[model samples]
Target: MTAPFRPLPFLSEARAEQAAGPRLRALRQAAQRAREAFTSEGAATALATCDLVSFPYPTVFAFSGAARSPAPYVMVRHRMQVVRFQQEGTERVLLFNPSDYERGHEAPFFKALREKYGTFVTTQVMTRRHGTVQAHLEALGLTPEDVDYLAFDHLKAQDIRRWLGGDGQPAYFPRARLLVQRAEWDAVRCPHPLERVWYVPEGTGGVPPERVELLSGDTWLGQGVALLSTPGHSPGNMSLAVATADEVFVMSENGVATESYTPLQSAIPGVRTFAEQMGWEVVLNGNTRENSLEQYSSMIVEKVFAGRARADGGFVNVHPSSLLTRAVMAPGLAPTITLPPPMSGAFTPVAAPRHAA
Candidate 1:
């Protein structure tokens, strides 16, 4: 069996918010301040808004929570982002964690989850736009072949075959090279017991070997674009560190939202409780409970890198609730919080993984 699910340590705070008291008032004040950061008029700047994000969707996992909802449990979201820039004067288009490959095959992703979690989950990806990679590229006025490179923080719920092709299907982005960490690739072949249900069927089975550029540890796909292994959410879990015009942005699922890392200070009740008790760094992602200790470490690493790398506090979590959509044009979807500038320097580079079976 997979490791036991660790319940959030802030249940009391959630309960506290229900009662009328000084603590409740304080918590409500904090929560309100946090919500204000997501409004368009807030202009809360830490990390610059993303250049382009794939269809923003809510994918409720077996026990995931909806964005900003009172639900303190349940992992959700799972969105993607694509970046475009020039390296040494060469135009480059990089897709970060490209998902929603084929709308035709959404059921299998959830079906696999049901098999492993022993419960039916609503795997639907709620998107106002088309939920396909092509749609993302189209929004940017580009095509799959135009993509210079592709990378994923980790490949737990991802289906590379969706883009690389499988089961006799043709590759989605024929010209792009997949920059996957060697450790992440290994897990794709032999997933941990807890991860069996998160991936797509035959996800990487049909990829052409030449299309993959596997790295043993941290690596640079291009100037100012790097793949760093953070490894907590999944053994091979990693983060993308990109130095952009606005500032440096760290994209990882570690915290899953701006709410995870902030003001060494925050207003959200659960966040405030965890921050006060566990220390602000104790905040972590909504998924993966097997290695709470390690995940905590990973989130710390993420906080340091993200906090320092950007100013606006936009860690660019793949699963940030709609309430904290850093750059969206919608209400309650704009970024609200900007952590004080990162205090520390860059984190130690990722080393090759030492797996435990």
Candidate 2:
């Protein structure tokens, strides 16, 4: 059985260093065990990615202080991961970051963008929606009713109201429970001034309390999947770890690119030199830096858990949930390398179980 979630402790520089060694050792062992179980039981069936939308994001935030590009913005495309697995002879589905694009614009950051860039440029020229999550589910022969769980790395632009039904509205995914960190739940409800910009106003307001599952810390959902608490970007930031046939994939918004974890090997002009000069191993996404040290530590945990990528040993298998994409709208700002959905196998929709008459 999986242990119940608990609160993660705050990490000072010294405390982070002290905890890193033991935490890494334990993570490695856990990953190894999960992999073995996956092979033996065939616990995991398939994992697929759905591209949602692309928009302009600040270049400075993408690489922290490591980027030297003249371009002010970089194009980033957000994606959702659908994982199919089984536990106790029952099939399950987990959706990671299934963002509601229409409701996303209410976020303060996008509001600011529209104010600065003009409505036409910001909405029409720069932002592009690939498809809706509902459409993606339809393509896979699944339904809103079929989704078992919904989660986010951290709820920035997210509004749980529509999905869970709030203020007397009907829910899109009627049966899915939202797995969110307790700290994150609090943070979103009462955002600090620094956090206000990334969130939507009244985003979680009126959402049914029973629809949310508040996790205290790290949690093992099943045999091949776990949700690891990794704070810093937000008070309750977490990453998804899934063990597959070939390798273990860690998904989060911890860093914007694989090169963010391996800056020394980055082909981006200033990244290598900046890493060497600063004597830093990883470059942060740096959107919110108030808790820089703790975020750094959390990122290190992600790096170790992901292990090195098989395609290129220099990089780790940390896939950014909102990946920096190549586009003409954003010039001179493309990631040197990108990892497509690394998990293998195709999703086969499981029929809903019949109840006794």
Candidate 3:
């Protein structure tokens, strides 16, 4: 069972270390600055309580089978918060996928796939049933009674199409738009020529209403900053780099693993191969075995950290709640930053119960 959502305090150090880039030298410099800031600011005793908001998104489950079966089941893609910020003083959560949730298990399907395929090829398959509901409603050209269902299917299908590089009609959503890098946009030919698509440049833009901001640099919004493309995982997988008065942080969702040891390089192969038929460098266990658990784990950690920063008074809260806590409480002591456990339930895998043969 997942724990109830709780507003977390900020990391005081994050504010001071906000400029830490991807380089080790920058990271070390940021750390030092964070320590100094903690001593001067005088830490707050109690944590702040803030309202938490999240978008509803579907969950994915992966299963593995034998060679003779369909293909090796691997990887799941669920909606997750990508970048968060304040709109007119109200906290807004930007979701990668906002859609209706469905419950289905993939284990049985894997069993059957293994039986038929012998050595299953690496692939992630969605049930035909999943797509049918959306197709029927879409063909009508009339909005379905449940807009959520339609939206869910549209988003899921888009993800699938993008992965497959298929030439099917592009999916469009009036309420939300795809926030993509300039390079990615360059490669894609808009199926709907008249449809408007917002292209975010590499870093710098106010959070525009109804327009997704594609960022390229480290720029701050109300509470967070946007970090552009840090590819190695996926061509388009990008992260929002952020910091406050004390600590520095990055939310590289699905781009890196939550666990400290595993990096995004480890999980990219399986999903990349299944989705795009492209070979990737597997940094985790050298074997090209398909598994993305670690990759998702790493992403979850970044998500929680970002969430906590928001809940608290931005990055200032990060340090006191994290490593610089002791230093802030007692300035003379050696600065030792101990990161808290990641926000709970940020990356729980959806389990598929049973699939029909």
Candidate 4:
């Protein structure tokens, strides 16, 4: 008789407790000051007031205490910023989160965050305004009419479809060759729809030869840089590790957030299920959707602790939660990129075997 197939166990309660140890307490303390400033001055003024802002969420605090099991965590989907940096006269401009397809109607939400946080948060405004088609043209130093045929074209139709729902034709963008881990790619294509849904591309074609490079094994990308395959949130989701001149920054893509601590008072069951499938650990911060300063502070503290511990010896920085504030604040500390040495022995792919559809 064949043994029954078993799923990986969720985070154990014991693990969760350990995860929220003393390190978490320190982070919470730091977050308290930030949260107080945000509430007292409002998000915008508080952000403008900071000497150096790292992750610019409108507010950061804790809401829930502990959970019985390691179920998927839920985070409040608030307005966020997309960050990118260039090496100055190099072909490589490290693009953080690219321009999202949803806009126009979504501008109010974005505007609200900006209003609360301040205008320091910069987005690929041109892309957000004109759509990815035009944005990629600008990236390649070309105009829409300049190229005879669009190359390296890979668009995420499903994400577009969801956000655009009943809107006009979904936007498309130039396909850059991604440097994703093998396990991450498999998780992205998992049959469990929500597990890898957000970033699962409908198609990947029109790729340019010059722009595509695949990293097959455990290897660093740039000098003293590594890419981690963090699969809980999205399948192809990965974080960047940069050991810089000053500190080590791990750019976790879809990890936990301050809002994830809130209780599920009125979350859509379907959306909650989706969040779970994507591997989030949600807790209730309050009985309502509205968050309080204390709760925000607690959550931020937890996130910081977890983020730092995950970085181990490296210093860490996260993408700002509030876009408006981030745009204005100077990049805070030098980024940290930590890469644990590869395990000794022949490398084996960590992906589960793909089943026939």
Using lDDT, give the best candidate's number: 2
What is candidate 4's lDDT per residue for 170-201, written digit by digit as tens?
32323233344444434434434332222334
Give the alpha carbon lDDT tens digit for every residue of 1-357 in model 3. 011111112222232344323232333344344334323433111111111112111112211110112222222223222233332343323332332222111223333443554422312223212233234234323222212111111111133232111244233332333345443333223312221121112111122323333333222222333332332222333444333344444434342122212222123223323323322221221111222433332233334334334334322222111011111222222222233322221222113331110
- For model 3, the superposed segments whose C-alpha errors exceed 4 Å read 1-24, 27-77, 82-84, 88-91, 97-177, 187-212, 224-229, 240-257, 260-357
Task: Rank candidates, TM-score, best first.
Answer: 2, 1, 4, 3
TM-score of each: 0.63, 0.89, 0.33, 0.34
TM-score of 3: 0.33
Q: List, in order, the clash count of every candidate structure.
A: 11, 2, 49, 50
Provide the overall lDDT of each model, using Cα atoms, as 2-decimal numbers.
0.49, 0.79, 0.27, 0.29
In model 2, where do residues sit more than 4 Å from their true spots?
1-43, 354-357
Model 2 residue 144 distance off true place after TM-score fit, in angstroms: 1.1
The global Cα lDDT (0 to 1) of model 4 is 0.29
Top-TM-score structure, candidate number: 2
Candidates 3 and 4 compared: the better one by lDDT is 4
Local error of candidate 3 at 300, Å?
Answer: 15
